[model samples]
Target: MDRATWDRVQVLLGQFVYRSHQMRYAGELIHCGHCGSPITGETKTKKNKKTGGDKQYVYYRCARYNDEDHPRIRMTEAEIDEQILALFDRMRVEDEEFRNTFREQLRRATNWDLGTETKNED
Candidate 1:
């Protein structure tokens, strides 16, 4: 909620920007759920209402849904992550290089910008 907190979030999220294997998705956040066209990017915010008040999560929803012209289904963050992870789990084991890259990328993301922020007692 303060400047220091925002700065930390920015830095942590920044680390995730330039990576290869971590990006298992074939399309950017801009891509539409139907036509596969580029749309607006995901928006980030602090989810203070959650149980842990986790600040790390960044969420995106298609803006086209709000448009009267384009009516489409909205998806959840958990759903999206599940789909990507499922795809990765099913990735061809014959490709040793790809599997290795996936492993390495997962390791990097797990360790990246990790730090403890205090839990809100109120």
Candidate 2:
């Protein structure tokens, strides 16, 4: 096959594989805090009354949400994204002391590598 055709085939195959396993955060990425079960992802379609168009929304929820004692809470993908962003914001290292320590470690590693190389040359 030609180069362009081969590239197109590869793209189509990749899309097919992705669709076959469409769950984005259902496996080991997320787990239920309440039940300790893996979170599952699902797509819900809602029909817009005015435009008669279907809007699809992705949601993540505990796999045991339907169980008797599990909390019946489902979080939209957007909500999960916001929570993740907030977590990252909270985890950001802004301390000057930490920065200095990291710089020192990097400098030491570089110096050690240089020393090893010089010794090997002897």
Candidate 3:
């Protein structure tokens, strides 16, 4: 891809990361949505070890697959960001009240009072 396109992808991916951590999945920021593996550097392709069957697929990789300790399923940053945008589009058309309440929850939940448990760690 050209530099301009790549730059745009970076912006969208950044938004995806923020929205995912704050709006949807808290403290569970992670790899590509398709494979659930880390995106290494700016490379556009990854060797994805996909899981699930038929329509339920999860991509991931183990250490043995990549010759590295952190074996991550591979997917393009652009692809993953596109998925996030799709989600954002759907949520944008959802109920207005729901969106407001969701934002309110995000605000309240952001301030830590020592009682909050992370979504994945707990």
Best by lDDT: 2
Q: Write the per-residue lDDT of candidate 1 for residues 7-88, one digit (tens) a residue.
A: 4334333445433223222234346766655544343335668675544432344545576667555433334444544555
Write one digit per residue (lDDT tens) for candidate 3, span 11-40: 433433332112221122343344454433
lDDT of each: 0.45, 0.54, 0.36
Top candidate (TM-score): 2
Ranking by TM-score: 2, 1, 3
Query: For model 2, how does the per-residue alpha-carbon lDDT over 11-68 read when each residue is reduced to its tens digit?
Result: 3334322231245456656779987888888776667588998755566788888998
Candidate 2 global TM-score: 0.55
In model 1, which runs have C-alpha deviations exceeding 4 angstroms? 1-30, 42-57, 69-79, 95-122
Better of 2 and 3 by lDDT: 2
Candidate 3 ranges with C-alpha deviation above 4 Å: 1-10, 13-29, 32-38, 42-73, 93-122
Candidate 3 whole-model C-alpha lDDT, 0 to 1: 0.36
**If scored against the real structure, what TM-score would every candidate get?**
0.38, 0.55, 0.26
